[model samples]
Target: MRVFVLDAKKRSLDPCHPARARQLLKSGRAVTYRYYPFTIILKDRLVENSVTHPHRVKIDPGAKVTGLALVRDDISKVVWAAELEHRGEIIHQRMLERASLRRSRRSRKTRYRKPRFDNRRKPEGWLPPSLESRVANIITWVKRLVRWCPVSAISLELVKFDTQKLQNPEISGVEYQQGTLFGYEIREYLLKKWSRRCAYCGREDVPLEVEHIIPKSRGGTDRVSNLTLACHECNQRKGNMTAAEFGYPHIQAQAEQPLKDAAAVNSTRWAIFEQLKRFNLPVEVGTGGITKYNRVRLGLPKTHWIDAACVGESTPKELFVKCSSVLVIKATGHGRRQRCRTDRYGFPAAHAPRRKKYMGFQTGDLVRAVVPKGKCVGVHVGRIAIRCRPSFKLNGFDVHPKYLKILQRSDGYEYEIHSVSSPGLKAGAPDAI
Candidate 1:
């Protein structure tokens, strides 16, 4: 335990004060002792032994210590303590008056262990679907903005781009635009400036060319002001001479397309917000359904579903989503009755298939069967007895239908069901019948 001595009148243990001293009397379990001018706080016993020199002591702010032991060797033991202002009568030098200190010392040891839900089959929490969706929408908007922003303005805009969430892979979902040429490179620039058409001929008849109003070989520098779009044939014919020198009238032009600053182009936050506006969701949700839906819509796959039950009372809540892939949540309500099936749009649904579908198999239909070990195996190609247990008896052998997922007749091993495209005549033609 640690101890500190303080002046009764001046609570501050100033180093220059003669009455201040802080010390460690003992260490282990926890106890205390009094030693004349100063008291020793210890674990088991108090040692009354006196030393030649009082060790200089420093106390943490707000700690209180008392007793004559605070002073030692005819000098003040307190050094480097805050000065306590105001004077009090020193009727007796270093009087050992004291009171009880009741606060307990905190443990310094740390704990390391895995959480309790390590092997839990289901997720602990699920965000409301709406919140998840809105958050997802916001993230997607931001990601798309980064993708379509102008190249020249990208570098500067990236500087002001909110990096607070850039590290979150679920939020950024950004793929940097790629091409070897500089942003100002003519072909791409022209594509941006003129919409990929020849300005002079006003035709998209062929690939366009960047022709100089004043030729570079004739002292014309590479400047947008001296450039115009031309067809390849026209560019070759114009060569290094001004249109005026070639006996053509000069075409005056206004700034039809001004270059976007890299900063303006790169700043994609506004675009992201615009994109997020479409995902109308409640700021709060009932059971995290909204949050989960938004996440699924936005294509964020990694955000863990959170349930409302496990959160702390004081914790602030927020749903998180991404713009990259599906977030599938399996339902545990059914007793594995859920079968794989597709919805109206051909996307996989979370619900399982009905049991009646399994009844579609017929005795004469080509079906794979699994067999138990033995050189002698049952080969029943025709219709056989139908047992109430849902097994078919062929050639005096009984087999369960569940094995159909992995059964192949010739190999004597189990075979999976028919592929979706060719689900056998019975299943394939069910609607027709």
Candidate 2:
């Protein structure tokens, strides 16, 4: 892990090794600052003309999870890695809920107003809230990392313009006759994916409609990956219920679509590229094919951050920390956007916290509570929700402050350091190990 540092005046400096930071802390020369990014504050004066390492930031943007890695110029190792899980789906679901609530309220005993439409025109390069959230999240992390590390160059994966060749090796030239498959061809594809049988009920040679694996009522999209052919009886039986709810255990095997994922990447690829160009650093772009090729060439396992480590011009050949702890920085935007928090009946659900900070801990502050003797005896690490003194709710568990150690201060959003141990590593190894 890269250790961020600050001079005596608190001005940001280039990050150093974790061992150096630990040595500084042990020798009373520096003190720990942030825990998530693992920063340190120096008590000594800033040494003029200190050597700096050339750090490169690699980002593999995805629809749900974005992979980010900071590596030295040589790409021999990843100093820091993160998997940023976006809240795009949650935002879209909340938008649907808001619309439902608004319609319900409007249909009630309320004044009828003419619906406003066409009054506002979408600006150029308009994207849905879900897509916009992902773009903004990538931009947020890029700007934030520049402050902590000496990142001079950026590598971003833009898979929107990839040559989408058919996966079937037999199909080519004349097989590509009428552009792409359709009608009976799509039916055959669905049959091939589902083993030519019903998804929920095993049957053969029956009339089937192009059924949505997840019903439309549940906000499932019209993406072909969500489409499957099911017999008329099975389709009717599976109305509005998920495949799992309809007694299909392994029915979603066909949901993985690189094309659909690439389409999602296309929606915001240029937007993110343009935004990154606005920065002063040099930006380099690559395709998803090269990303996959690099990962396979290096024999790296499939993980968001692992893919990120092998992204772009500097193809990483190896990782020093095989099973490094991943910093999952979920996008929990500043606060609620609604005017007032309300319940389903339109009544005030609850009051917001009066103060941002309670005692010393705030809602998003990362704290570790080690209760020596209680029901919560084990060491629990999570963000603190300080409503009551001495005791506060952590992600969900309740703990007291006496045993709580503040790891990182609240920064509006929540972060988690998942200590994923490498294979064959001893259990006694430290989290950083």
Candidate 2 has an lDDT of 0.75
- Tell me the lDDT of model 2 at 296: 80
Number of the top TM-score candidate: 2
List runs of model 1 lying over 4 Å from the truth: 1-184, 245-433
- Per-residue alpha-carbon lDDT of model 1 for 350-412, expressed as tens digits? 664354223444332334454554443544343343434577755456666653332211211
TM-score of 1: 0.16
Q: Put down candidate 2 lDDT per residue, 211-257, tens digits, no spaces.
A: 98767668666766778888899898888887768877467555533
**Collision pairs in model 2:** none
Model 1 lDDT, full chain set: 0.31
Clashes per candidate, residues 3 or more apart or on different chains = 44, 0
Model 2, position 249: C-alpha lDDT score: 43
